[model samples]
Target: MLDFFIQPFFEFAFMKRALVACFALALGSAPIGVILMLRRMSLFGEAMSHAILPGAATGFLIAGFSLPAISIGGVIAGLVVVLAAGAATRATDQREDASVAAFYLIALALGVALISMRGSSVDVMHILFGSVLAVDEAALLLLGVVSSVSLALLAALYRPLLLDGFDPDFLRSLRGTGGGTLYHLIFLGLVVVNLVAAFQALGTLMAVGLMMLPAVTARFWARSLPGMMAVAALIAAVSGYAGLLLSFHANLPSGPAIVLACGAFYILSLFFGRVQGILLRLLPTRHLEA
Candidate 1:
């Protein structure tokens, strides 16, 4: 049992690197996930993940799988979509969700077309579903930098974020005209950065899973915002470990395996979590005297 769990990381450099990458990703991305869930922008993270594809494909075209180039491209592309979506929402009758959905769909199709122009299906699979074993020192460094920056920004913007989550109108009123906008932009930027970081370990599609699933599960388990963030982070890190081990032993794809692990947690939380799980909700309640 010990060797099965410990030997992989103990003996293999790639495994060690992958584990560290997952932990770092969870630390930064999980809290952001909580905020997104609270703000009912859960799908926004998914849209942003797909939005990264065009930039990453552009990077692949320019540098042939160079990590930095891909990351930089992804960041630029994701941020552009975010800003564009916001601008469109403000300018048009369409809501923010509709604008974001439209942009991501276009971005996704464009990204695939660009990658197909230069590479084969195998390359596309590699980009869309990453191989954790391919993680290198540069990728590790990028993950660390992104995670650190995300945590710092989240801390600095906590008050505004809390307000945005609970009462957007109140937050806007408190900040006055255009007050909450900066924080919203910053929050989206953090989401983009973390998604890029996870892109190194998990592919574009699976990356959002790590960010959102744990948060969704945490909602069932934790009542407070801080508690939800903590539980989500913990679930993400644990899922990373379990998923890596499952991949090592069963020859599964690393990214999807990790995501599946998160999915499993979600299922369990839905049935058994303390806050409002199906089981708990179905149980009989004791009568109370008024």
Candidate 2:
């Protein structure tokens, strides 16, 4: 039984690459996910993920599966949406949500159209879903570089970002010191880079799940921001491992398997987690009933 669990990863080099890539993603992307949840920016994050599709599709059209070009294109596309949305929010009387929604829809339509131009349904599916088990050295390097840069920037901007996200007035009050602008730029950059990295292994929809599900699940059990980020990262890493194992045993697609595993964690947390789980709330014998 132990061998069953251990042998697959040991016997297969691809499994090792997948594990490393997932762990790197968890370390980097999960923290960003935590902050997005705290800021209630999940919708924005999802929009940005969709925005990555057109850039990636264009890259595929140009380079035929070149990882770096696809990542750069995705980052560029996501950043453009972010900048445009931010500008429109400030320029117009419309709400930020509405502006972002419009931008993301446009981006998604462009992505689908670009994809439709070159690839068959199977090829398109590969771009949208990715092949996690087929991660090669170049992809690994790209993930590593993106993860490292993201973690560094997140660390540098942590305090200002927290203030900006949780209390923008306070963040703005400190704008004279320049940390506010730094936080805004770096935070946006981190989102773009993390999404690009995640999309490489998890694809567009599944990649967003990798960032979001763990954060939301961690919300059930964690009280402090730091604790929430830590739990989210752990959840992401564990989901990656379990998902890969399940895929190996059952012959499921890796991207969707990892995402589905994250969903399971979210469901379990919703019902049974110790903090604010539904099961706990429903227990009439508890002294904490509201």
The candidate that achieves the highest lDDT relative to the unseen native structure: 1
User: How would you encode candidate 2's per-residue C-alpha lDDT over 1-290 as one tens digit per residue?
Assistant: 89888898899999999999999999888889999988888887888889888999999899978887898899899989988988998899989889989998999899989988988898788877887898999889988888898778877778888898878788777675466766777787888888888888888877888898999999998898889989999999999999999999999999999999999999999999878899987877646555
**Global lDDT of each model?**
0.92, 0.88
List, residue by residue over 16-79, the lDDT tens digit for candidate 1. 9999999998999999999999889999999999999999999999999999899999999999
Clashes of each: 0, 0
Q: Give lDDT: candidate 1, residue 13.
A: 94
Please list the residue runs of candidate 2 whose C-alpha ends up more than 4 Å from where it truly belongs after superposition: 177-181, 284-290
Candidate 2 Cα deviation (angstroms), residue 18? 0.7
After superposition, the stretches of candidate 1 with alpha carbons farther than 4 Å from their true spots are 288-290
